[model samples]
Target chain A: MTDKIPVTVLTGYLGAGKTTLLNRILSEPHGKKYAVIVNEFGEIGIDNELIVGADEEVFEMNNGCICCTVRGDLIRIIDGLMRRKGKFDAIIVETTGLADPAPVAQTFFVDEAVGRRTRLDAVVAVADAKWLKDRLKDAPEAKNQIAFADVILVNKTDLVTPEELREIEMRVRAINPYARLHRTQRCSVPLGDVLARNAFDLERILDLEPAFLGSDGGAHHPDHGRDGAHAHHHDGMAHYHDEEIQSVSLRTEEPLDPDKFFPWVQDLVAKDGPSILRCKGILAFQGDPQRFVFQGIHMILDGDHQRPWREDEKRESRIVFIGRNLPEENIRRGFAACQV
Target chain B: MTDADTASLTERTRAIVPGGLVAAVHFLKDTAAFVLGEAALLLAAPNREQRRVAIHDGGILAAACDGQRLVTGGDDGKVMATDAGADSTIVAVDPKRRWIDQVAIGSGAVAWSAGRQVFVKTAKSEERTTDVPSSAGGLAFAPKGFRLAIAHYNGATLWFPNAAAAPERLEWKGSHLAVTFSPDGKFLVTAMQEPMLHGWRLADAKHMRMAGYAAKVRSLDWTADGDWLATGGSNQLILWPFAGKDGPLGKMPRMLAPAQGLAVEVACHPRQPVVAVGFADGLVLLVRLDDGAEIVARRPGAAPVSALAWNATGSLLAFGTEDGEAGIVDLG
Candidate 1:
C-alpha cells in the first residue's frame, strides 16, 4: 500500500494569523503545491491574489470546512487530487475559526478511501496572545482549539509584552504540554518548525491533556492527578469562569461492543450538546487486538478499526474528551458500562 | 418562558435536522425520504414506497425542484430530469463538457448554464444551445415566454429560448453574483461581487447603481409588489425602494448587525412583502420590507444557512443550511 498523505489541520480563533501563516507557507521557496481547503475562497481573496500558482494547481474547497457535513466534499476533493498524484506535496485544511477540529481529524480515520490516501499530520493551532488569555476563560471554541493543537503558535507577540507572552505561553503549555510552542508576530516562524512533523503522539496526549484520561484511583494516574490540580489552578485564572473546556481520558482493558459504543456516544452528545467540543479514542476490543478509533464533535460521531496491534504492544482502549465542565465520573461510568 | 427554556426549545427545533453529515433529503409529494450520495436513494414512507432512480453518474452538484419534477446537475456534466413523486421516466438528459452550474425553468422551456455554454430545451422537441466563452454565474427565468437572463462572469445576456433571434448582451464588467428580474419583468437587478448593486430597465437598458455594503453582496430578493429590493452582505441587510429618481432613494439603512450573524441567504414572502434572512450562524430573522422591523428571530444553531425559499402560500418558510439540513417553519 502507498503511504498515506499527511493532512495537517491549521485552526485558530478568528483573526489569529492563520491566513498569514498559510500565505507564508505558500510563499516559501520549497516547491510544495498544497491543496488548501478553506471555508470561503473569497474571504481570502487578497491572499489568493498574492499566491503564485495556476488556479487549477491550488485547489480550494470554497463552500465550507471538512467536518461531518462537508466530509463528503473533502473525501471527493482528496480522491480527485490523488488521481492527479504528483501535482501537490501536501494537503493543508484551514478550518473555520469556530469549527471543532475533532470531526475533521476523524475523516482521515473513518473513510477507508481517505485512510488509504491521507493520514493526519498534526492539528496546528494559532492563538492570539492578547485575546486568547481571556478567550480561554469563556470561549469554548478557543479552549477546544488550543486543547486539540499538537503545535500551538502563540501568535501576535508584538501585541503583548515579554511577561504577558510568557504568561500566555505558560497557559497554553498547561493546557497542552505535548504541543510544541512558538511565539511569533503575525505567525512568522520557520516553516520547518510547524510543518512535516507528525505531532500526534497518542501516548504523549495521554500524559498532557489527562482531563480526558480518567481513572477510578484518581490519585494513581499521575496525569489525571496533575490535570485535577491544574483544573483547580485554572479556576483561579479568572478568565476560565466555568471550566467550560476540560479534557478527560478513559482507558479500559476490557473489550467494548462497537454497536453499543455508537449509541452511548450519541447520548453523551445529546445531553451535553455544544459544550462537548471534541472526543477521540483508540479502542482495543476483546477479540480484536486491532485498534478502533472513535471521534466526535458536537452531534457528529464516526469510528472505525485500524491495523492490528503489533506483537509487543499492550492492548488497551484509550478515549479522551475535551469539553466544558465535563462530569468525569459519570463519563467513566458510561464507558465502564459499555465494556462487553 | 425563561430565556434558557426558549433557547433550548429553539435548539430542539433545530435538532430536527440531523447533524454531522450532509445527506440529501428529498420530500416527494407523498413520501419523505433521505438519500446518501454513496448509497442508493431510500424512500422510508409508509407502505413501502421506495424506488432508486439512476439520475447521477458521478455525484450530484446541485438539485432543484422544477414544478413537480426534480432537475439535477452533476459532476458528470449531465443535467437530468426525473419525476419528483416516482422514478417513472427520464425527462431529458443533456451532456456537456463541464458540470452544469445553475438551472431555471419557465413556461415551456428549461434553461441551464454549464461552463461557457447555455442551453434551453423548449417543447421537449426543440432544443437551442449557445456557446459563450464567458462562464455563466447565475441563471434566472424572466416572466415573458421563452425569456431568460444569464449572468456571466463579466456581464449579463438576454436570450430567447426558441432561438427566434440572437441573444442581446447587457454589457457591464464585473463578477455578478446574482441576476434577478422583477415580477413585472420591467426591471432587472444584478448584484455583483463588487459593492455596487445595479438596476437596469429591460426596455432601454438604462441602469442605476446603489452602494452601501462593504463586502460582496451575497443575496438579493425583490419584494412581491416589485417596489422594493432587499440586498444583504457583511451581516447587514439593506432595503432599497425602487421609487425615486431611478437610483437608490437615499441612504441605505442597516437592518441587522454583524453580531446577529452574517446574512447568507434571503427570501421574500410570496405575498406580504416580508423578507426572511438566513444568517451564517443559523439565525433566521423575518423583516418587514416597509419598516425593516424584525418580525421573528429564530436561531438554528451554528450551521450556516445556505438557501431560503417561501412556499407558494407565503405562510410556510423552508430554509436549507450548509450542513445539508432543511427546516420548514410555519409563520402563522
Candidate 2:
C-alpha cells in the first residue's frame, strides 16, 4: 500500500484571493514539493508568475471548471505525477471561482488508481469578507461553496475593519461551523496554517450531521423514532428563490443493491438532468464492507470501489446532491424507493 | 407526384404553423416541467378532459410517445415516465453510467441505451433488465410494431420484443449516434456523430452513404413522405431531398432565421414538408422546404431548448428546455 498523499482543495467566489494564497504557499521553503492545478495560468493576459517553482509542477486546464470538461485531463495529470512519486510531496487543486467542490473531492474517491495515491486533506475556501456577504444573498453557488468548505480564509482583510471581518467570519461559521477561520490580506496566510489541516474528521462531522453521521461515527441512525416530518432548517444561511438550488445529504445503514441503486440514479438524472449539478456518495453494498464511490455531473457518472473497510471502521453509506430547486421530499422518497 | 413536386408541396405546407403557439391544451392535473439541461421533458395530459395515461419528457437522447404516456431518456442516464395528467415517475435510473443517450418505445415495450447497454421493459413486467450490448448509443422501435432497432457504438442491431429470439446485428465501422426506421420498416437510417449519414436496406443490409454537416449531427428526423431527411447541427438545419433530381439535391432546411444556436433537437412535421428545430440557446425555428423560408423563431425561455415533438395531428408542438420549462405551440 502506498502512503496516502494529502490533497488540499482551494475554492472561493470569483476574485476572492485564492490564487494569492496559493502563491504564498509556493514561496515558502517547506521542503515539500507541491503540485498545483488551476483553471487558467494566464487570464486577462496576466500570467501566473508570482508562484515559486510553478513552472515545472503547475498545470492549467483552461477548459473551464476542474470538475466537468477537464476531469479526464486532471486524472491523467495526477496519475502521471503520482507515478513520479518523489517529484512532489503534496497536491493543491485550485478550483474555478464558480466550481462546486463535491465533484473535485469525488474524483479522489471514485478513481481507484488516484484514490490509492492521494488523500483528501481538506477543502479550503477563501472569501472576500465584503463581497461574500452580498454574493451569498442571491448566488446559490456562492452559498454552496461556503457550506461545503472545511476551512475558510476571510481574505481581503485590509478592505474591511476587524469588526466587519469578524461579522463575516461569524456568518460563515453560522453556515458551516466545522471550518476553521482565518483572516488575511490577499490570502497571505502561513503555509502551515493551510497544509496538513485534516478538516474532515469523520467523528466530528458525523456528530454535526444527525441524519447521516451518527454519534457513533457510523453512518447509520438507529432512531427511526424521529418523525418523517423532520423539516430542514436553512437557519438563515440559505437564501430561497423560486428557482433556488438546494443541497441535501442522505445516509443509510442498509446496504443498497447495485441493480436498484443504478437505475434509481439514472431515473433521477433523466427526470431532472438540467437541475442536477453534482451527486456523490460512498455506498456500502450488501456483504461488502469496501466503499463504493459514485460521482456525477449533470448526466455523466463514474463509479468504482475504493479500499476495503478498515477493520476499525464501520460500514455505512451516505449520498449528497447540490441542485436547483430540488424537491427534497420527492428526492427522499426516491431514495427510500432504493432501499432493499 | 415526382420528387420535385413533392418538395414544392412540402414547402407550401410549411406556412401552416408559421411560428406562435402551434398548439396548447392544459392538463387537468398540474404537471411540472422538468429540464434535462441539454434537453427537457414534461408529463401532462394532451387535453384537459382525458384520463392520465402517459408522461412525456422531451429529451434529445430519446423521446417516446406511448399512447397517452410519454417517456424521455436524458443524457444523465435516467428514464422518466409520466401519464398525461400525472406527475413524472423515474422508471429507470443509472447515475453511475453514461447518459441515457437514446430511447424508443412501441408495441407496449420500451428500450433505452445508455453508455453502451440497452435496457428494455414491457408493460407486462414491472422490472427492467439490461438486454443489449454496452456499445449501443441510439435506438428506435419499428413503427407501430414490437421489433426494436438499436444503433450500437460501432454498428446496429435489430431485436425482438420477446427474449425468445437472438438479436440480429448489422456491423458498421463508424460510431453510430442516431437511428430511424422508414415508415414501411424497409429502410433504416443511421447518422454518425462525425457528421456522416447513411441509409441501409434492412432486408438485405445494403448501405448508401450521404452528405452530412460539418460538426456533430445533434438532431435528425425523417419526413412522413420518406422522401426528405431533415438533419441539424452547428445551428443550421439541412433538408436532404432523398428523392429529388436536383444534382442529388440537399438544401438548407428553411427556417425562421438561420438556427442561431446549437441545434439540439429536430422534428419533422408529421404530414407536411415542414421541420421544427430546437436550439441550445432556447430558440425554436419552424422551417419550410418549398422556398426555404423560416416561419417561426421564438425563445421560449432563458434555458437551452433540449427536446421537441409533434403531436398525433401534427398540429401541436411540444418543446422542453434545460431550465425546467415546457411550452405547447398550436399550429392550428
Candidate 3:
C-alpha cells in the first residue's frame, strides 16, 4: 500500500485560482515529478510533459443505485498513467468549475485497477474570497465542492475587506466545518497544506481528530457563542436555509455492538446515500480490542480492523457524515440505538 | 488432482527480456511481437532472431492485431501499424493531441478512438468519424461486415461505416469496456466496468448478464469452434458456453485450472480445445476442455502475466509479464 501513487484532486469555482494553484505546484522546485490531468489542456502554461486532457465522463453503475457514480475518464487516464509508473512521482487531477467532486473522489473506491495502483490523497477546493458569498446563493456546485473538500483555500483575499473575508470564512465554516481553511492571495499558500494529505486513508482517520473535534465540539456549533451565531446566520442564507448541507458528528463513550452497528449503518447508507456525500467512522466494538476504521463514498463502504487499543488511549467511538439535507435527529437516534 | 499429475512444458520455453512492461503480445505467423508499455516493440522470431523497433513517442495505450499486422494506439496521440517484416507506418495522428484510447483492426480497414469520437479508415476511402455519448472505452470490428462495435458509458454502439443508416445502440445502463463479436457474428459481448460480462444476442437484442467475477474482466477470447468465450477475472478459468442459440443464458460456466492466484489473462488455442491461462502470481497453464487436464507451461515466480497470445497454427504460445519477463513455448 505504501508503493501506491497518491492522487490529489483540485476543484473550485470558475476563476477561483485553480489554474494559478496548479501552475504554482508545477513551477515550484519540489523536485518531484507529477502527472497532471486537466480538463482544458492548453490553457495553463505548465512545464510538465505528463499533462493530459480529460472529458469528465461520469458513469453510473448498473445496480440501480443513483449515488454509485464514478468518473470514467479518470479510470482510463489513471490506467494510461500507470504504464509510465516510474516516470512521475504522483498525480494531480484538475476538475472544471462546474464539476462535482463526489464522482472524482468515488472513482478511487469504485474501480479495481485505479484503486489497486493509486490512492486519493485529498480534495483541495479553492474559493474566491470576494465572490464566494454571492456565488454560494446561485451556485450549488460551489457549495458541493466546499462540502466535499478536505482542504479549502479562500483565495483572492486581497480583493476583499477583512469583514467580508470573515463573512466568507463563516459561510464556509457553516457548510463544512471540518476542512482545514486557509486564507491566500492568488493561492500563494505553502504547497504542503494541499498535497499528500492521506485524508481518506484508514490509518490516518483518527490522526486528524483534534481538528475534527475542535470544529464540531467547540466554535462552529450553534449553541457555542458569537462565531457560532455568525455561522448559523450564514447557514440561514437563501440556498440552504430550510434543508441545508452540513456535517454531523456523533460520539459515545460506550462500545458499540458489531451486529447492531453494521446493519444500521448499512441500512442508513442504502436509504440515504444520495443525500450523503461522505461518511467515516472509527468504532470500538464490544469484546473487540482492535480499532475498526471505515470510510464511505455514497453507498460503497470500506472498513477494516486497525491496530489494537493502547492502554493510555480512551476507548471511544466517533463518526462523521457530510452531506445535503441530512436527517440529524434520525441519524443521532439510529447511532444511539447501536450502543450497548 | 495434484501438481504431480500436471504435465510440464517449462523446459521447452525460450525466454526474452523485452526491457519494459509488456502491454500486449501479437503473433505474426511464427514471430511474436511484444508491445512494451513504453514506446518500443520487441520482435522475436522462431529461429532466435530478435529485433527492437521504435513505434510510438510515448506509452502505448491499446493494441490489436489481424494475424498479419499489429495496430497500436499510444498516449502520444498517434495510431500506428507494424507488419511481420518489422516495417512500421503512421496510420493517423490526432490533430488536438488527444490520447488514442482504443484501436481495432478489420479486413482492410482500421479504427481508433480519441475521447468521445471514433474514427475509421478503409482502403480506397476517406477517414470517417462519429461521436459516442461518452469516451469510447473499447472498439471491435465485426467479423463478417464493414461494421464496428464501440463500447462506452451507457452501453455499446454498433455502426456500419459504409451505410447511411443510424448507428444502433444496445443499452445496459453501465460503463462497458473491451467489446468483441462472436466468431460467427451471432452475438456481441462487452466486459463492463463492473466485474462481469454483458452480452447481446444480435438476432433480438436480448440481454445476457454473466456475473460473479472476482475482478473486472480484462481479457476474453473465443474457442476454436467459437462455442466458448473464455475470460479472466477469477481464481479459475471461466468459459461461458456460446454454442446453443440461447448462449449461456440458463447454464453455468465451466471452471477449470483453479489456482491460488487470480487469473488475469487468457488466450484460447486456434485449432484445439485448449486455453493458455495466466495468473496474477505469474503462473501459466494450458487446460484441455475435454477432461480438465492441466499443463504447467510457466511457474509462479515473477510479476503477474499481463499479456498472452497463441499463433495461428496453435504450435506456439507467447506470454509477457508486467515486469518485462516474456517467453515463447513451442508445443510441437
Candidate 4:
C-alpha cells in the first residue's frame, strides 16, 4: 500500500485558510513533490508550478440539500498526473468551499484506475474558528466537510477568543468527534500531522480521538447518557448555532445479529445515502469471534473483520452516524432489533 | 474469454516479482525482460531469471525501446538507458527537475520533453533543447526517419534531429496526445482529449476522425504491414484499418476480445495477424485481428497490466502487471 501514491484532500469553507495550508505544504522542504489540484473557484494562492484547476460540480440531488452534490473530473486529473509518474511523490486536492467531500473521497474507492494507483491518505478539513458558527448554519457543504474529515484544523485561532475557540472545537466535535482536532493560526500546523495518515486502512485503527471512542473503550459505556444522541452539554457544548447537522453515536451492550444489521443498514443507505453523509460502526456479532468494522460514504460501504477479539478486550457494538436530520429514533430501534 | 482458458492461465502464468505496480514491459533482447513501475525496473533473462533495480525515485513517466536497450524518463527529471546486460546509465537530467513528460528513442538517438521544451540527446551532442508551442502532450520518433513528432494543444509538430529549419506543424483544434506515425510515414494520428483520434494523411493533410470510443484512446500500435492500427480505450481492441488512402475513414473498425475491463495496453504482433492486449483487471489476451478469436494469457487478478511487448522476431510475448507480476511467454 505504501507503493501507491498518497493523496491528501484539503477541504474547508471559503476563507478557511485552505491556501495557507497548501502553501505550507509546498514550501515545507519535505522533498516530496506534490501535484496540487485546485478547484476552478478555489485556486490556491501559491505560485508554484504544477497547479491544476478542476471544474466545480455541485448540482442538485433531488432528495438532499442543493448545496450537497457530487463533483466530477477528479479521476481525470489524477490519471493525467499519473502520466508524469515519477516526477511527483504525492498529490494534494484542494476543493471549493461549497463542494462536498463524499464525491471527492468516493473517487478513490469507486474509480478502478485511480484507486489502483493511489490511496486516499486522509481528508483534512480546515475550520474557521471565527466563522464556523455561521457557515455551519447556512452551508450544508461546511457541515459535510467537517463530518467527513479524519483530521480537522481550527484555523484563525488568533481571531477568536479562547472561549469562542473552545466552542468552535466542540461544535466540530459534535459533527465528527472521530476526526482529530488541531488549533492553528494561518493554517499553521506541523506537516507530519497532515500527511501519510493511513485513515482509510481497515485494520490500522488510529485512536487519535480517544474522547469519541468513549471511556469504557469497549463492552461498556463511559458517556452513553445521551443514548448515542451525541448531545454533549456536559462537555462545554454551548449550542450557540442551531445547525441541523448533528452527530449521533449509538452503542449497545448486546452483541448484534449480522443478518438483521446488514439488511437494515443497506436499506437505510439506499433510501437516504445523500442524507447520511458518513456512517461507521465497530460491531460485535453473536457467535462471531471477529469484530466487524464498516464505513461508508453515502451508498458505498466497505467493511471487514479485523483481528480476533483479545481475551482482555470488551465485546460490544458502537456506531457513529453524522449527517443532517438523521433518524435517531429509527436507528436506535433498528440496532435494538439486532441484539442477541 | 472462456472459463477453461482462464483456469489454465492462472496456473501457467508465473509472477516474476512478488509485488509492486508493474508499469511497463519491454524485451531487452530476444528473451531479456524489462518491467517499469513505481520507479522500479525489473530485467528478466530469457530463462526467466530476474534482477530488480530502482531506476527512478518517482514514477517512470515514459519509455521506449532502442535496439537491445530501453530509454525511460521519470518524474525525477532523469532520463535513463537500460539494456539486457543490466548496463544502466543516466543519459540526461533536467537541471530544474521538471517532470520529463514524454520520451522517444530510435535511429540511434533519444528525445525527451519537459514542460514546453523537447530535448534530444544524440551521439555527437550531449543534448539540444527546442521549445514547442504548448506543453508537450506526446512525443514519438518516425519509425523510418530521424524526424520526431511532438503533440500539444493545437496540433502535432514534426522536428528533424539535424535540421535547423522550422518544424512542420499539423494543425487542428483541442489538445493532442499519444501521437503515432504510421510505420510507412504516410500518416500521423494523435489521440484527442475528446475520447477520439485525429489523424492527418501526411500526403494531402486529409483529416481522419476515429471517434466513438467510450474513453480517451491511450495506447496505439500499428500492425506489421501498417494495414491496421490496434487501439485501447474500448473494452475490446478496436483495430482501425489504415491500408487505404483515407486511413480508417468512412469505414468501421473491427473490435475484438471484449472483456470486463478496459484495454490499457496493446501490442501488435511483429510478423502475424495477432495482438496482445492488457486490461485494467490484469488480464492479457492474444487475439487474432482476423476473427477476434481470443487466447487468454493472464487471468484477471493483480493490478492492471500497464505495458506489453514482443521481441523483434515476434516469438516471445512479455507482460507486467501493476502488482509487479511479470514474465515472458514463449509463443514461438
**Best by the TM-score measure:** 3
Please, what are the lDDT tens digits per residue for candidate 3 over residues B73-190? 9999999999888999999999988899999999689999999999998866479999999999899999998999999988999999888998999998899999999999999999
What is candidate 4's TM-score against the reference?
0.61
Q: Candidate 3 falls in which docking quality class?
A: medium
Instruction: Give the lDDT of residue B62 in candidate 4.
Output: 77
Q: Calculate the i-RMS of every candidate, to one decimal place.
A: 10.9, 17.7, 0.9, 9.2
Query: What DockQ values do the models have?
Result: 0.02, 0.01, 0.77, 0.08
Candidate 3 has a TM-score of: 0.95
The deviation in Å at residue A18 for candidate 4 is 5.1
Off by over 4 Å in 4: A1-6, A11-91, A94-112, A115-154, A159-183, A186-340, B1-15
Best by DockQ: 3
- Local error of candidate 2 at residue A187 (angstroms): 24
Two-chain complex of model 1, DockQ on C-alpha atoms against the true structure: 0.02
TM-score, structure 2 vs. true: 0.42
State the C-alpha RMSD over the true interface residues for candidate 3, after superposing those residues.
Answer: 0.9
Q: For candidate 1, write residues B1-332 as lDDT tens digits.
A: 24564454345332234332223343444343333232133433334445565565554544445335555655455666555455634434654235455666666567776655787777675777776536565677887766888875456888877666888888675555468787678777787645567667777888667766655576787878777777777565677776444535344544643446667777778799688887778777777655655644466565667566665566556555655565555544
Clashes of each: 12, 34, 0, 7
DockQ for the candidate 3 complex? 0.77
For model 3, name the residue pairs that clash.
Answer: none
Model 2 Cα interface RMS deviation (Å): 17.7
> Deviation in angstroms for B260 in model 3?
1.4
